[model samples]
Target: MRPDPQETAPAKKQRRYWHRTDWLSLFSGLLFIGIGVRYLVEPPPNTGVMVLTLVFGLGFAGFFAVVSRAFRKR
Candidate 1:
């Protein structure tokens, strides 16, 4: 017996939340890069701002890498 056409129509796949993680990470990285550039061009009185931007940029890059790896299908 065949199924009803309405029932058999492939269910639209639900989008995974993890799929957005990579894009979020990329955006975060870009934001940090902008801050880093600003600090590089106009050094802040406190060294912490520069350090923070470097950490933020690197951390986001690492996050993107890990998420990309996790989502990769063999």
Candidate 2:
């Protein structure tokens, strides 16, 4: 059967600069990075801040890397 001329093709899903699901990922990533930076800028009140800095810094970096990979253009 031939397709109806009146019916148009379904729209293709285009990836935007920021996708809905990625919103939290992106926000968390930035938040962690900010926290990490704060740790670095402020003097270490205790040894825990050092660890916090490392974890958050690395976590955000990895998160951004993964997001970037997923969003890479073909």
Candidate 3:
């Protein structure tokens, strides 16, 4: 007798649940949104200052993410 096609096929892989959000990327996204709003309302006078702020803000977000991960329950 021939085996059933369904039985011969490999089992499908189930995806694991992702419970936590990526904090660093989340904060970075918010920062960009806020910056976009600010740009539309009142543009920054200096491009250099805006660039510096972005760099520092991302650094701070990264630090926060690391600290959060360190304290999170495994």
Please list the Cα RMSD from the true structure of every candidate, rounded to 1 decimal place.
7.9, 9.5, 3.8
| C-alpha lDDT score of every prediction, in listed order | 0.72, 0.68, 0.89
All candidates: TM-score: 0.41, 0.38, 0.69
A best-first ranking of the candidates according to their TM-score comes to: 3, 1, 2
Best by TM-score: 3
- Per-residue lDDT, model 1, residue 62, is 79
Off by over 4 Å in 1: 1-40, 43-45
Worst 10 contiguous positions by lDDT, candidate 3: 43-52
lDDT of 2 at 50: 57
What is the C-alpha local distance difference test score of candidate 3? 0.89
The reply for model 2, stretches above 4 Å from the true place, is 1-45
lDDT of 3 by residue, 1-71 (tens): 99998999999999999889789999999988988888999956588888988999899999999999988
Tell me how many clashing residue pairs each candidate has: 0, 0, 0
Question: How many clashing residue pairs, candidate 1?
Answer: 0
